[model samples]
Target chain A: MPGVKKVGQRTIQFANPPVVMATASIVGPKEGEGPLADCFDKIVQDTYYGEKTWEKAETKMLAEAVEMVIKKAGLQTGDIDYLFAGDLLNQTISANYAARQLAIPFFGLYGACSTMYEGTILASILVDGGFAEKVVAATSSHHNTAERQYRYPTELGSQRPMTAQWTVTGAGAMLIAKEGSGPRITHATVGKVVDQGIKDPNDMGAAMAPAAADTIITHLQDTGRKPEDYDLIVTGDLATVGKALVEKLTQQQNIDLSKNYTDCGILIYDPSQDVHAGGSGCACSAVVTCSYLLEEMIAGKYKRILGVGTGALMSPCSCQQGDSIPGIGHAVVFEMS
Target chain B: MGANEGSLLDKQFQQVKKQAQQQQYQQMAQSVKPKQTWVKNAVAAFLVGGSITAFAQIIQNIFQSAGLAQKEAGTATLMIMVFLGAFFTGLGIYDNLGKFAGAGSIVPITGFANSIVSPALEFKREGFVYGVAAKMFTIAGPVLVYGFVTSVIIGLIAYFFQ
Candidate 1:
């Protein structure tokens, strides 16, 4: 059957839909504190698991976040049709454990710091495709947890340079539904992972800012949108160091997101709040998107939002082997209609 | 009745006098002869203080060998030094070290780590506002301010030269 013959009386149309529903964020330790300050510190601390694997910490964080998101969405454990999640761990154990507890059909994803955007994009696609009525997308990371798993244990007494970011120990979850009254995820621009082969992990802000700028500029170009079109453009975990670099580099392309752009890494922790410089982690972007940004959107404070998640694609092993650090970023747009 | 009361008071006074005499004798017998002078104590403090930096270097070597980058290795070394310094500080050992070494512990890259982490951990104790919030940027404030100013100046100079 020809295409026109198969749908003689049907027509296709494109419309921007509203996000019908969203939910709460749950974090460890104190509300404004790092996760290591909590009970998990004791659970994972002084143990072989705490000293060896980040998987345990990621699992604990995701379990807590998923529980909160599911309860808030008024859905039961079995109600979710699919689970899309990611983290910075080797096998993405955060998503794995969350899937085990939630018992939803699962797809594990990884984009390093950009995991949240990757999950959100997939969730939106699932909803738009009519493949699922409800999908839960979540991501999380812990500083001590990731450190022990990915780098060194606390007992090892490793020193941190001025350029190194204190990985934020936290998690964030969001429930994306096909029929919701909240702001719809209108469009997403997938970024090509770019590597300038910068080697220093201590100066990650400089390493990743160029990739962030590339994605932001290209997203605007593809969508035929200008910076002024959105109220704010938020980037994932650039911290104070990266935030400055991003602003400076973007100006070279005549694309200035600085006036409206803010970094999740900087906003998550008040430097004066004793968090040292700013926040970094998959959770940095996730929590800010679900809690801070979502709240602002609901209040009519912002009509349109652009969230760009950036990741530095360098592993401890990779860096140690004298390999260059490649950078990657993904941009997703959400609008209220 | 008056005769009996006077005898009772005399008995109590006699008992107190015997107790004081016994205490004095015990103190005299227990006292030890002094061996080392104040100079020895000061010298001991110096040795202990200097050892911490040496220990930190040992740790840095291990980190370097383990495949950490130079900056990362340096940071790890500094963290160990700061921790050792703080430990000594808590034990009142660092005070003596600070006096004797006089920035020996404070002058190295490790000293930089101590300067940042100590204030941060201290402010963290005061509660979020005065503690974490107020002190979060306590150490990094100067670095950031100076960094920003210097970068701008450099950028402007470069632009003008061009």
Candidate 2:
């Protein structure tokens, strides 16, 4: 049972680890102005992307990202056994519509901002379990669409508080296969929905920090690994506030995530951009991981990395009804093969 | 009373709530959740809001000096300010100003025009009926409803008192 697939309570160690064959990141104009502008596969000049609306643009981004990932792997669409995709829209219309166009076996997911790692975890499970040979995990989030759906109309002149994170307008896709020459997903940690009674929607980082800490703690305990074991550890969309909170929280658990830890939200945009706290959304992690992390891993900059996708599970109605924001964190360990 | 003074059930409830708060994480998050620049925002509001009002007054004075009646000048000033608000909103300038000016831009009549015009222009894509007409009042609707309600109630109270 030492090499057993089920490693611990919350983590699964793949006996046959799935390789990340390729990754593609497509970001909008605002994200293009960010520090990781050069890292993206394509920097779209228009939020509409020649589409009718921002939502449709998000759909196009996800579809193009999936197509681009498959192309980068030099594989046909028929080569991909299954496609896992999600977005922040209600009913995950972006994922569904994108899948509708892809014509592959699709799994529509909704984990808020954590959908990227959530899809990665699920895809890895399928590939590692000998279910499918090639599975592509893709997720997207548009700044305008997310803003209109969750907060306010895109053109609303209301000043967002400092804690409010700017939703990233981008899409990321990764082709995970049984055999590939790239980083392999070694261990996957499934996070539980952890709510800390944080009610402020603007303070998503605060809401998600505890959940990220919980998952990180669980992954560490289950794998018997320390913070120093990984070259880099990142939490998705936690931004500056959540990153700091995760550090202190993990320190309390004696995990000490300070030295090797960073956040996608903090990484995607520079402080000079005035993106309030930072970036948050499914694509915030998806884009950063698929682009910067993928490139760095391939360049041998990071040997092993832990990506924790953190999501605040709150709806506009729930927030309005005074329900606190519950959050989840899904972690995927990637090591250079 | 001792620091832990409470009923047994209260103590239990407090414990549960504390657990939900994820004590350390929540405290750390609260401590670092991005401090609001209250003073800076206030200063900006004062400067921008005052400037807008002064500009409106200058426009009114201009109208009056142009041989318009005092009441006509006041009415013209309101129209021009609202026109400017809507025009700038269409030009996509008011939103940017509103983002920076905060309450300064929002507390004025121009802000009210912006509140209405912004949604109308944004939702124009859904067509004039549902998109523009329906969503036009999204921001301004509440203000109109509450304003009218309060005014009617105040008028009734004043009439009864008199």
Candidate 3:
């Protein structure tokens, strides 16, 4: 905690807790269709980014999310002072497009799914330290959009395993303000990037679990709290497979979070919803955390919460070339006063 | 009165006879005749088909200049060329061209796009929901979903093993 500065420990109780003011999801109308269908149809519809680039879809979602947040906050575009965002796409098109439309001073960040936390942490810091009066944090993901741009075209037949998390096709945005009305982010424990360099990209959940557990355990240690201290500890986009793996591994580390720990990936997709095992994406964590969990928090359903965002640092090209995947996790704690 | 009735009947009979004569002449003119015009049709098809391929090459050049990777550019070139080829085919020009050019248009990305879209357009007449919707995704859905899932698994394995 030496590098961590305690800025404004008392003067700032977020008049509006960095609450998710609003959220939106822009899925291609062709649900259950292939990537080719979505891209082709989008091109026909004259969508600007429709040429088989996932960057386009991510950008669209980010733009939509920003629009919704601005409207929800009942504020004009000029009212916002800073925009912090990121995504998995190269160059971070989601943040870039959103920045272009919102036209505010921007900071582009990347931590994979942990991007949400990165945005949130930065916003909180800016607000608490009195650097900015109001800041908005947002992130997004798209299955076909990201896949075609990052990997291969949709027409190439490939095999998949059950252990994988479905890259979610959605986006989420949140507004953090210094003096509004919302739940304040009270405490946060930022984690170091941990990489085990696991070789398989398909089983990201398993690969990321150790880092997730490490961050969760470290956050608890630093905050001088136990697993029971927070009502719920949520990890971003660690599917059912990763969730189980994290649970088992944390127990080995003498940290048991079985009952309270859950994954955003598993929660977003109803297995009955036929989303194929669980959800995975930058938005997997962003949307679920902002929309569902924050809604519950606002309703006084959960008091103290620990939100951990996990990321797998493997590119499709590197994976296809047989390179090992490195995983990272970051944790941010939120409390309701 | 008798003279007038006879005259009117005679006029009506002449009119019927004239109509029958014209009908017979029109039938003869409308009859299908086997012409040895295959050579002409074939030549037309070839010229049109060649022009389509040339246009496709132009498009490919443009895309190449725009910084598309070779594979992507090739696919795009194929798509455009095939679509043009299909248009000429519909005009009865491509059939002749096919006989001469011999799969020149049929062998590239243009041909593949034509194959997919032509069937898709045909299916669209069946309705957007069942015909176009169901069949369109049939070819590409599994591939993308597979790529996505496999990548995730690959990412996981890489993380875990490390």
Candidate 4:
């Protein structure tokens, strides 16, 4: 059992990596109006997605994404073995309720914004280990639902700080299988929760950048690779501020990420969108990866990509009690033939 | 000093060094973080909030000119202002205004009405009794509680003095 699937320190090197069979994205009107609008499979005009409440709307979007991914793979719901998913809500109720509707064997996750990659790595491990032949990895975030739960009511006449990020109202899902002709999940490095003692809930980028840098560094060190090894290295939601910090932090460690590193938050929106720092939430990375990046990978634009899902692990309760925000970044490498 | 004491000294030194490094990281984060738009927000708040207060004064003046008592005119003006706030909130304009106005929109009577009405409208989907009624006072509850408590304290002081 020694060094069978494990890499140096805390990375998993899949001997036979699981393939991403299909991907589906369902985004809200605001996201649909953004730069990558045409990339998504479906775009709902309203944030409610025809549901009564924003919470129910988020559940619907996730459930639809899961079903769409399965259908895109030309498989029935009963054909999938496990469903790994999460969302940025209380008790992960969005994922839990969607699982109830989907009726698949489920593993409810709570990795804050980093949950999509967490689900991906776990799905890859299960598929690679021959435990589950096919499974679904998905996560969603609703702008109104996140606001009501984390900060204030959606219509509260409050101004967000310039450093504050706009949560993406969308869902992204992927079907991963043991044998498929698609981009394969090759390796992953799960990050440690790194807290640089940043306390402001508004400045989430700064809080998460250190963790992203640390995980990137460790991934490189563990796998004995360099930044040039991957065609593109993208962080989940560092936006502008955290992206700069990751560049600086990694540069200090003599690992120049200047050539290839980018952020999903920055890429998701244009400067005109006025998303201050940039787009965030679980859907930020998931939607961007499932839509834009995956399409590019299949089209031979990018062959090797290291997608780092970063998360600021502060709750409303923790921030209210004056505790510093802890951050995490989980990385998953995807390579196309 | 003995070997134990020397090792203790080294440990303390390491702790101090780590603390300094941590402080450096915090400062770096603060530096790179987008600076607060203090002047812009403050100016906008002043202009917007001041305009709202001035408009209320005009409304109060109009009621007084219509031959109402000063207290009656003030109450009527506030009611009009609250209605306008709730109206804009319902029409989905106040929150957008607030995004630019900052505290300017939030400090006025209209902002207060928006605070109460926003949650009421948002939570309406959950059910009237538990959703709207229960969540209505969430934003403005603290203001009402503290306002009443202070009034009671001042009233007690006045009673004892008299």
For each candidate, what is chain B's TM-score? 0.42, 0.83, 0.38, 0.84
**Candidate 4: which stretches are off by over 4 Å?**
B1-18, B152-162
Tens digit of lDDT per residue, candidate 3, span A193-307? 5554455565677667767887777776665678998889999988877787677667866888887989888876656644444778887788777766776777898888888
Query: How high a TM-score does candidate 3 get?
Result: 0.61
Per-residue lDDT over B23-47 for candidate 2, one digit per residue giving the tens place of the 0 to 100 score? 6556667788678899999998999
The candidates' DockQ values read 0.01, 0.56, 0.01, 0.76
Best by lDDT: 4
In terms of DockQ, which candidate is stronger, 1 or 4?
A: 4
Give the per-residue lDDT of model 2 (tens digit) for A166-235.
Answer: 9999999999999969999999999999887788899999899889999999998899998899999999
* lDDT scores in order: 0.67, 0.91, 0.67, 0.94
Task: Per model, state how many residue pairs clash.
Answer: 15, 0, 35, 0
**Model 4 C-alpha lDDT versus the unseen true structure:** 0.94
Q: In model 2, how large is the Cα lDDT of residue A283? A: 97
Better of 2 and 4 by DockQ: 4
| CAPRI classification of candidate 1 | incorrect
* Candidate 2 docking classification: medium
Candidate 3 chain A TM is: 0.85
